[model samples]
Target chain A: MAFFRSHVLVCVDPECLARGAHDVIDALQDELVDQGLIDEIQVLETSRIGGCEDGPEMIVYPEGVHYVGFNADDVPFIVEEHFLKGRIVEKFREMPKVVVDEELGPLRPKEVRIVLKNCGYIDPTNIEDYLAVDGYQALGKALFEMTPEQVIEEVKNSGLRGRGGAGFPAGRKWDLTRQVNDFPKYMVCNADEGDPGAFMNRRVLEGDPHSVLEGMIIGAYAVGASYGYVYCRAEYPIAVETFNIAIAQAREFGFLGENILGTDFSFDLEVRVGAGAFVCGEETALIASIMGLRGEPSPRPPFPSVKGVWGKPTNNNNVETYSNVPQIILKGAPWYASMGTERSKGTKTFAVGGNVKKPGLIEVPMGITLREIIFDVAGGMHEGRHFKAVQTGGPMGGCLTEQHLDLPLDYEALTQAGSMMGSGGLVIMDETSCMVDIARFFMDFTQAESCGKCTPCRVGTRRLLELLQKICEGFGEDGDIEKLEELCEEITKNSLCGLGQGAPNPVVSTLKHFRHEYEAHIYEKRCPSKVCRPLIRFEITDPACTGCTVCARNCPVEAISGERRQLHHIDQETCIRCGICVQVCNFNAITVE
Target chain B: MTAPSTERDIPALVRAAIEKHGAKRDALIPILSEVNLALGYIPGEAFKEVRKQLHDPTEGVFVAESQLHALASFYDMLATKPRGEHVIKFCENAPCHVVGGKAVWDTLREKLSLKNGETTPDGKWTLVTTSCIGLCSVGPVVLVDEDLYGNVTPEQIGDILGRYE
Candidate 1:
């Protein structure tokens, strides 16, 4: 085997792949082979890099110098200057140091980065890369050094709650199954990250699959489970593929399969790819899907810990929750407990997205304020747009406004503020966003995903959607607000599972925080943000009109009129309200009011 | 539409899918997914064949046809009806909508002359709205078959759809 002094690790994650990183990689490899430098320098492709905004970025190892935003043309220069000559390419150093704030600076580390430590560093497909970083050592330690009881005790002491939104203590869940006395207890790693805006779990599975595997192995040992299944959604093909490879590699390394690491304990895992269904993220629904049945959540009391997959006791934990287990085991429980708040322990990974300047996956210690996450970690709202609200926790979650920005983010605090810490999907919204539309959007999602097992969820969600749709379409009645409030309460109280019970969160929270916007939509027949098509109209303001004819030319339905060098008029009669004219108007003449 | 002869031949295809999974009841979703991959949609004949295979008294575990159809109809990826060659899944969730998804959605519908969940008359494209594909950072996203197009604008919709055919 040939060894190289330096490695060129490129970013080929989803975002980077979308940005033509593959072509740049192809160019880099061709250049390297042409220069006869393949033996001297090893080229590797790592995952997300976290700094997705400055994509197609790569690092030349030994120096640890990162070059950002490079294309095919810049590769030959980097290879010649950095690899061939022993000098760093100064011109290609577009990304400021990891600490220093660059142009899109919030990608910097205000984060503790426990969960995301290996994400941007290692090649996910290669187990050797994972091993080099002390990957399976946690599982080895748990299997050999500590007793199963000791491992469970450590987890209990750590206060590591479930990151899958419910915030149930991981140790307590395992203990529940351990005491069940059921044979063949199963451990399922819920990689079905169904929360729309959240890709934190996806990144963990794609960038560091083995860490989750190691975590699952430790959980299996602690909970006395012999078989495990990873239920990953089929939409995330990359995550599914990477996890399968990790499973295969671990089996080969003797970390999985019978008598792992020369121990009496035996555990094996297989991947059960989920067909498209959002509700399958629920533990019961997930178990049903794994059983090749319709993914539907049954009532609780008899949780998965009591009777789960194939009628055996099962312990299901979120990917992030499981990923944290290995770290909690490797480092002592107290060490893990020391990072987070009094109640919610350790770090939380959030897929920070939407209108943020530098949106990407970030892991920060608990008790970090939302303001800090938005402004310090994510660089605030993009394009100087004023902050409206940040929607966390997907369909089951609510939106928090500027007033709640300084609130410490943890399970209890968020719940107290009327939102749950639901899988940590923080979607930053700017002033352009309409709270009514946002509420309706989440309603639409839950309504579609409702499994129809319960009347309240299946029927109530449709009614809530109807009310929301009525408000958005300028048909909101006098008693619409009261009707909505009553429906929200009824749905929350009567729903069978989390999907229905938490379905009204978007509406309730929007009513609490952005009530004035809702009132405007209902009473005045006006969308405060002008997002509702029926409530707003695009008009050419004469003072700002340059008569450029750009709006007229770009109108999808020929709604704008008037000749070049003359004030144009928007023909509302013909307009489809597609917003193409507003987008194409160069003179700042178009206004939606 | 499949010919009557082709409909008769579905049992062989269904048997191949059943044989792949050893006719286990727990492998029903995988079988349906495999059959959906082989045939464009899980036809009524395919489900009947799967039901027959599942009830094989020797090796197969019993699974009712009602249960199979219920499982099949529940999943968004599985379709009972015939679909177009290319499936265009547009993200219609809040994050995508917040970042100009409505304009792109409008353009797509107008250009294709089809509403959401409607396939083109020529059977070239099936437009459907998905909740999220977990790439919300680059919002207003759409997936044509396997290829994902992110940060999609109304103008880019034409070029993106153009590449599909």
Candidate 2:
């Protein structure tokens, strides 16, 4: 293989591609050959090197200089000056902007960004940007100044817990693996963020991959491990690509591999892509998937700390948990532990989505209530909608009603409120959302994702889903609600893994808060929110009908019949209850009952 | 569009994937992913080929074809049978459903005249419902082949599908 002194990464994002980036690349290559520097420099195609508005951009490294808004004509001068003569062409050079303005609006006052500190503030692909902002300082400190035990003690004092649903203490997990006398221990970073609405881990992995890597290296050093793996989901293609690039760059910089930073510590890691299995997010199942087996969770007695990955001891932590290690090491333990509540320390990043006006990612301290998160951070619900409930966590987590809005957003508090902080997927709902239908939606997700390992999760969840479906379809009997509660109890008690154990949480919590909604659906055969299709009907009122023929023309099932300028009628039997007429109506003529 | 591979190419494709990754048990998922990317689905003959070549002398592990099929069927990304020329995966999770994803989903289904996991008669398009691709901030997301369209409305489904075929 041939080696080059510098690699020039040209941005080929859609915007840049439309702006003649390809012609610029051809010109750069032709000019490099003319200068006899083709063998010395390498050209590579990369996506989104920031400043996409100033298209046709390229970044040259090891100098990490960026040149933007240049066409094919400017390539020769750039090559002649920068590549051959070793002088950066200042006329075309422009610093790369931190391109995260769209994802993260202006940082709010209530937000405390420890894990998200460098997310939008730096160029993710370039290590120099991370290095300038005290990137590997903690790794250097831990490797040279502190002992393995001292590193563990500092993390233990920081009071950090795993951010991946189950809030196990991070330092304790490290110490447990360290206590094991097994050889060749492994540290695994769980980036398999499988929650439906959550993108917190994806954002961190794509934006600041080095931070997670640096933290993993420090954790591996403290735990006496030499190898690590970052298990990222296949859905997040951008994150997996960014993390691979970060790993290659870290290995090239001598921060990874043998004798890192000129110390005796040697550590490295690789990315393991998950194949669309939500169960693989669990620790044991994730290990099994890494070993090329089916991703099914087994009973835990050998816990990963005792027996893991090829039957050797291993340590596993989520991406957010690992990303917190370097900061806890660089800043002292007290400084890191000063924020957040008593039990839960530091900040948590939430992917707040659905119904909320400013639906995006936010990182807030632990004691922040659900009200503050919804109203202050996410800018409350959308116009003309009243907040009904917020579904924190994901499919397995329960729904928090309006009564629980003031509850604090810690692990313990959320768990006490019958919902867990499952990877911080807060999907808000408005008054238009039907509680029974929402429960059915979550049940449908869990039933489909169930691995069918044990009987309760496999059969009981299906049965519960059937009951919920019956209620939604207006066929629920009087005893169906009681039957659902009993099945939920059995599934929660008898399931083997976390997937089965938490499968009934949505139904359990929804029934606890919205029992009246269930009663209305079963007894009166009416959907109060008019969300359940079988129980609701759409009709055109006689007086308000303009008879413009828009609804008749737009109907997919041809359910409406009317003249051009007269009253309209909808065939009740033929209407599919799609609600298209209501959306397309010029006047407020159609109503649902 | 690429031509479909015949049965004769299974061995060579499996061998190339194993050679590029490894013959170890841990290389199974990557090798399967590679083959799936090439052919859009894993043929039964390919599973037999993998079972023949994949072995670990140290661990004394040899995979069975049945296990390979089970794996292929378990993961949502991997397909056992052939799919259409283009696969369109729409988000069916609650985050999208609450934000008018049902209407877009209905529009897509009606436009293509296909249900979930069904392909067109001419094999032009296949519609599948995926859990989520992590773009909930812009709900009602659609993925056609490798291109992602977020914040999709019902009317835009025609334009999005038009760009595919």
Candidate 3:
């Protein structure tokens, strides 16, 4: 093997690639060759660095120096000044280099990472890279040292529950499968991470595919299963590709095929990609979809553990839940149990995004408060915007207000606060976000995603959406509030699956916290946040206006009229309330009413 | 999208797809996905071919063409009608919708001269609304074919779409 002085890791994640990180890689390589330092320095591309906002960023290893916001144009300077001359490039330096540590220094993790340990640290496509970081040690320990029942006992002691929204105990699920008398049992990894704001599963599958595979293998052993399937969404092309490579590599290493490591236990794994169905995230629906059906959820009487995929006894766990198993086996139950709260043990990974300062995949301890997650971990709201509310989970989750920020974020606490932990999607909203519109937004998602098998979810979601639509359009009647509440209660009580049961959460929670906003939309015919176009209007203040004609020129509907060095006015009759003038205006002259 | 190949021109191709993944009754979705990927859209003749290939008289298991068509229409990714040369899937979920997605949606409609699920008259582009593509932090996300564009602003709509054709 060849030894290199430094490793140049350029981020080529979707965010950075969109920002021209590929060009930067090419330019850096070309510059290194031009300077005759190509052989001396190794150039490589990696996944997301967690600093997605300052992407097209790279770090030089051994020195651990980070360079941010540099383009292809600055590559020659970087090669000459840093790689050749051996001097730090102060112009592009994002942060001071610290002594090398196991954790990510450049990204500066706000919380400990257990589920996301291998992500961004190892190359997902190469199994050897995963092996270097003690990849299969847990599986080895589980297979050789501990018996199948002992493995389940350790998990039960650790109190590790499912991270896939339902919060069921993972050990209990495995025990149920182990007790069931069946031949050719199965284990499944639910990589169908369909939550709109969550991509932690995508990151894990793309950055450390073997970790999930190793976790799945360990899980299969504990449950007495002979076969396993990893059902991933086809939307994540890179994740699927990486996982397939990991599976092939594992099989080659004698870790996946029949009689792994020459033991009596023989197991095999295959990949089943979903066809763009959100409801498939539900375990039963996912099983049905894997069986080549319409991906509809059947009511849970005999849970998936008792009778699952293909009408056989099966154990199904989400991507994050499976990713936690290996660490528990390797480190022991006490080490894993020492981190989190009383009931919810260990860390939970969340995909934090929206109007936050730092938006990326994060893993925090289970009991971390929403305030700490939003302000401390995510660096607070963007541009110092006032904290309005934060929406966790997905379409099924509810929006929490400022008063709920101090509440510890766990399955029980969030559910008690009128929201569920869901699949760990923390989307922060600023003052500009309207609660009524937010409810409408979630209603639209559930209404469309509802499979037609259940009438309550299918028809009730449509009716709730219609009521929300009427309210947002300034056509809400006097009795609309009572009617909405009645419908919300009825839907929550009568729905068949989790999709329908949780569909009313957004409206119910928003009404609990921000009913005044909804009242304004209904009675006063106004959007308090000025987000609903039909309820809001735009006008240019004369004092703030410089008569730049920027808004007038850029208006899609040509609704604004003004002259040079004069005031501008918006024709309400012609204005579609698209809010283009507000975005285009440089002088901050336009105000929403 | 694949090349504009008719059903009659690709019987061998259709038969090969069915042979590769049509052994089980549940292979209906994967078979449709493979055929759509190869022939752009699931043609009526291709459905008939899938039915014929899956019709195992000895096994007492036969897949109907109506079942294949129902599976095709149920999933958003599978389209019975051709979606032109390029397909654009815009995230219309709440996360994207709250973060100024409506403006970008309107701009796309105006620029492409088509609404959701409508293909252009020139057969150059098809616009559709998707629930979410899982990049919620950067709202107003657009996926053109396999490429994902995040935090898409209304002003960048024209330049982004121009790269397709």
Candidate 4:
């Protein structure tokens, strides 16, 4: 309960632990005790504070000095200088790499900051900071310079497709909504970013709320809409709060309310917090949720552009798509179109995660190869592990293998390769990741998040999950793989909305690429990655066991028992297979087969 | 936390919510969210109170109690049943799973002795699995009430849970 002057957080990630991080910790403790500074300084174990490759890493507070690649030998000097003398050890200090923002993650080399221009650069709450960066200039130009038809033409010339999974032309959507002579038309900003791993929209909404507001105001002006609603997820309380603040500020600055900037284009917006529903990401479902309905998607013959939000003409765009508007407006259409490929224009921001050395958000221009993104941007596989497949999108997206590494990351190229851009959530998997288990993981997500409006998504996804569960639990039949493929096709075809239609993507894509892994699970009853619990067993190897009894003491179920300095035995019957022993063990003693 | 809401306060709570957010079909979600925020969960009587108090003559939208219950149950955030003091939401999606989330999830279930969507006997903690909240870089993310902890390991689970109580 005693407060300490300094807290040293040592990285205890498995990769760092494997590289003698414990010895380093032990040395630091011994040195601190020897120096009589142990009482003043607290050493806490934290996981993955960047630079995992250079292990035995620790960060000193409140200076926030990061030190890496030091072993037990360097600990005494570190303690003597930093703790006692108040001098940071220059030898072990890790250089601040690339101006890492705590919220936005590290700024990478290949990142293009079009949508994320003011993300980490501006104070999101302050309107003056946004105005200093020419935030509302685009709105000004849109109102003063261009007509409604001309604005649509400029967007059409830019060749910017929607960033929200479906690559529909934004200009065409706006035109369609503009053409509808419906009074009290609506412009809804779809901020209900329900794609599990995708956070590009969240960052934008949280970081620079005005960008989205500016875009929405301009769109409302063009589409001749009086009122707009930003349908943000209630889960992201920060985004909703920030967006609400932005709306108020815009009204004050005359960017939003009636006769904005004295032009007679009257537009106002409010934040509609979505009650947790993944299907609400769909336009129709989003519209329904805004109306305080069950967030269930009906038939889409009449899209949101035609009839939406109280059965009036509505235009809905993803958060990222709307954020891109100001830049597209300020800069000419050709300037925006020049960055990406022929079909897809502008840079895309990806929430790159999973088994990568540098897992964070990266914005890269379109047509960049997957290899460049995974290797150059995300810093490749973690701990030099072998590459497996990369899952793009979320549950609705597919897994792409090494064969598609060189493929350009555009909408057409990705869709052609059995994957879609899907809000730019790219999760990189390594050799340790089991393909079957990965597919099952996504299937489980899609199955749970299904709105149950239709039979195919509600029932078909459940059946698919059951088949996957049967296979993973070593209860696979011979025809289970074929059965999965047939079911995926049925679900894909028969589903009413995008939720049901795209729910089979992970299964279908994984089946297409990693059918052999599924075959092995069904035919041999073996999980190659030793991930499926029933198919794999934990054991203590005799040679590698140092008789330390670390695993024995750490075992939650008391499954391991042995004398001190003797080899331990695991009681398979009692072992719950929680993998705690393996994580706690320092020696390479435990093996799963 | 605030004291549990009683049946007598249900009508007052519904009336206040209707006053705050207008008595329209579009205001139902915000109203329900406010009620959920005030009370841990919306009581069965509160739905009837809401239906009675909420009447949008302009839109001709007067929702039924059944419709109100349907909405309250559909969204994961709004709970119809009584919940624990602290809600612990663990990410059970693919992004977390691929990066050692299974072990953390297992450790959490073991530590709390509660399965998904179950509250403790003491009503101190409720464990529920949620889809990803976009902190993918720090996989194995856990949200306890409003505090979100990223880069969560099984070893850190006990400490995190202890912080809430």
Per-model TM-score on C-alpha atoms: 0.86, 0.87, 0.87, 0.86
Cα lDDT tens digits, model 4, A1-593, are 99899999999999999999899889888888898888999999999998699998999999999999989998888888888788988888898877645336556778888888888889999999999999899998999999988888888889888889898999999999999988889999888888877888999999999999998888888888999999988878899889889888888888878799998889888999988899999899899999889999999869878899889999998888888888888998999999989899989888888888887777899999999999898778867688899999777889999999999889999988988989889888888888889888888888888988899999999999999999998999888988998999999999999889988888899889989889889999999888888888899998788889888888878999998888889999999887778888899789998
Residue B136, model 1: Cα distance from true site in angstroms:
1.6
What CAPRI class is candidate 2?
Answer: medium
Q: Sort all candidates by lDDT, best to worst.
A: 2, 4, 1, 3
Candidate 3 residues A1-593, lDDT tens each? 78898899998889889888999999988888888888889999998654768778888898888888888998899888887789999988887545642212234445888888777778888889988999898999999999999999999998999989899999998999999998678999999999888888888888888888888898888888999889999788788888999999999998998898889888998888888888899888899988888888888878888889889888999888888888999998999999888889999988877777777778889899988888888788878689998888888998898999999888889989888899988778898888898899889888988887888889999999999999999998888888889999998999888999999999999999998988999889999988888998888897999998998998878888889888888988998877778888899999888
**Candidate 1 backbone collisions, by pair:** none
lDDT (10s digit) by residue, model 2, range A1-593: 89899999999999999999999999988988998889989999999987598889999999999989889998888888887789988887896555454356668759988888898789999998999999999999998889999999999999899999999999999999999999899999999999999998999999999999999999999999989889988999999999999999999999999999888788888899988999999999999999888899989988999998888899999999989999999998999899889999889999988898888889999989999999998898888889998898898899998899888779999999999998999989998889999999988888998888889999988998899999999999889989999999999999999999998999999899989999999999999999999999998997899899999999989999989989899999999999999999999899999
Best by DockQ: 4
Better of 2 and 3 by DockQ: 2
Model 4 residue pairs with clashes = none
- Model 2 CA deviation exceeding 4 Å by range: A1-102, B1-8, B56-61
The residue pairs in collision within model 2 are none
Give per-residue CA lDDT, model 3, range B91-149, as digits (tens). 88766776778888988998899989999898889899886677776678998987889
The local lDDT score (0 to 100) that residue B15 gets in candidate 2 is: 94
Q: Which regions of candidate 3 deviate over 4 angstroms?
A: A1-109, A546-548, B6-8
The TM-score obtained for chain B of candidate 4 when compared with the true chain B: 0.90
Alpha carbon lDDT of each predicted model: 0.87, 0.90, 0.85, 0.87
Query: Predicted candidate 1: interface RMSD?
Result: 2.8
